[model samples]
Target: MTDAATRLATLAEEALGAPLPLRIRAWDRSETGPPGTPVLILRNRRALRRMLWKPGELGLARAWVAGDLEIEGDLYEALDQLAGLLWERDDEPAAGRPARLVTAWKAARDPRVRHAVRDLVALAGPGLPPAPPREEAGSTRGPLHTLRRDKQAISHHYDVGNDFYELVLGPSMVYSCAYWDRPDAALEDAQHAKLDLVCRKLALEPGQRLLDVGCGWGSMVLHAARAYGVRAVGITLSEEQASYARKRIADAGLTEKVEIRVQDYREIDDGPYDAISSIGMAEHVGSVRYAEYTGILHRLLAPGGRLLNHQIARRPEPDEEAYHVDEFIDRYVFPDGELAPVGRTVSQLEEAGFEVRDVEAIREHYALTLRRWVANLERSWPEAVRLTSPGRARVWRLYMAACALSFERNRIGVNQILAVRTPEGGASGLPLRTRDWRG
Candidate 1:
């Protein structure tokens, strides 16, 4: 191995206190670590420079997204092993901050270190380049959660391309946590089951009005209108999604029964619907606006109407009051997205004057859902890259796989909460027993 490559291998071994779990192949074709392990190939010196300068997940992510780094084996498994080692290393006590700073200063003076540091500093900060080229970084402006900003955020994410989403989401086009009847159920079937589950929970009957807030491509609305005979109105911020949904609804011959609008949830005024379903959209609603969101839903639903709020929640420690995702996600994936604890979400629901009837945690289902998406993306990688930029494709691949790992580890959760706006002495309009919607 070259001297630089050898030094890097030695540094990694010392940092982890063991031989690296994965093999490393430097740009010069020099290899290190076990032969059979997943291989992390550094394409150039810039890869190592990026990692050393930023020194965390963001750095590694930038290297991967920039095509400076590539993994030759199971990415998820590699990440798992790396994460375990990092966690274990973090748990061990380290030198004080001042001592670490002094060490860093001393190391910064080395020729290789100085070169990387100068290059990184010359770029004017640690942040990655603005996205759509090397990354899919979100650049939304305006006040957070405002109608305009929400539209910007939603459009940036969902407007990537319909064909691209189809490759990832499959034929069902359901983007939320699917309800898997069996551990081996197909993704399409599971997605259908999840849609029907929401409809059954709403107890839709003929001629009832259903408002699907933050609906993506009208999966739930289409299912409800076609199967449950409900008049459904699905709203989304992405014009692309609304256009595609309208086409799908018309093609399905449900044009008369379903309406797809390019409108924000906060902009919908004609409401008092019998039921509302907010699937996979609450994460985008910052915690600061949780109350406003729940209140808006409450105002829209008629008395005795049901609201099915499906969202991703954070699983915090018993005494912890906060949960946060990585900075990379905030920039590249779901910008301004916030995952509130289930307790806080339920409290918001109750405080909005709705009776919280049920809160079902289905985190494992989400893990399955994300894995299926990652598999689909991998299978259609070439087509996905054709439909969107390479950077955007990489964003989805990395974020979804990482999120699947997080869900499996109980670091996050997906919950379907059923609430009802009950009038004085009125029933919740739900059956006492949960019906088998899959039937």
Candidate 2:
């Protein structure tokens, strides 16, 4: 084996408590191979030593960004291992009571840090009320617009600059997987197919009206209007997004068919649509009102109409540390957002009188998506930095990196659920074979 491989073998053995199992191939230091390879590939022992020494969060993060360290196999798994490396307990003595006192002292000095710490702590703490007000917005935004306020939290990170997003998310701004149910398809093709797949799952038809909840920049709206021949109404709380989506719809010459309102889903007046889709939006629906929130969608959809709820989900375990990081997302990237497990989601849907028809776990798909996004972000960082703040760049990196790790470790997941309401006073008479999407 080459010397670089030899050093990597040693580091892998130490980190994993076993020798490396697979053959290692060092690339041209450019991180430019498959879509989801390691962050970087080190060529020599010194570089590996340097990465091991400056072992703070940012340093290791930069090492990945700079293409100094690398991994193979699942990208998300690699990231989880890397994250664990940051907090690894080395030879340093564990301080007992003094550490607790120091932590208390630090918490007392900075309320912001204390809040952050508390959020993490609460995830692991005892059960609390279902719908506690997120601390980010204190009594100011009010209940009527609480959802809007949370939507703004999601918009903050996404609306930084269209160009930045374009670089990372690509032309579609899909924000979700491409539905690679079939092999040998390209990413763009898979994305378009996924959009079509959603439309088909909803069984959308020409002239049918559809409502898209939490439509980001209106990709699905435009797609449905153009491809499925459906009139689409999408609601978003982001001013920037609404404006852009409207312009895109107008430019597409489908102004009559597609309209996006800069309003909360609760305020959406054009209801009784034939179909409903909430892609990447359920995360923002606080757990306190999962039932009521879904009931609202059921009421909004016409009888027998389908509702597609796409969301990221947590595992069944009551993991508090996981919740802490999730709370961080609410505070920073997605204000007022809450992630629910599959059981909670299905229960809420069932309570809303909707029969769950299908559910698919796109965990690895999301990992691949985030991995590509991070890579695109890194590739375009130089140009991207000129357009946005350094903090913004760091936030994107950390958020996407953490997300990649989340999916890689199976700590989180993405689910696309198709549900339909019964037509009569009770269950719908529709055939189970009606679930087929041949059309």
The candidate that achieves the highest lDDT relative to the unseen native structure: 1
Q: How many backbone clashes does every candidate have?
A: 0, 3
Candidate 1 per-residue lDDT over residues 214-318, each given as its tens digit: 889989999999999999999888899899899999999999999998877788899899999999999998977889999999999999999999999875555
Instruction: Tell me the deviation in Å of residue 365 in model 1.
Output: 1.0
Q: Candidate 2, residue 238: CA error in Å?
A: 0.8
Model 2 Cα lDDT, one tens digit per residue, 275-336: 99999987877766677679889989988888989889986645544543343354446656
| Cα lDDT over the full model 1 | 0.80
TM-score of 1: 0.87
Displacement of residue 13 (Cα, Å) in model 1 is 3.4
Give candidate 1's error at residue 98 in angstroms. 22
For model 1 the local lDDT of residue 272 reads 90
TM-score of each: 0.87, 0.69
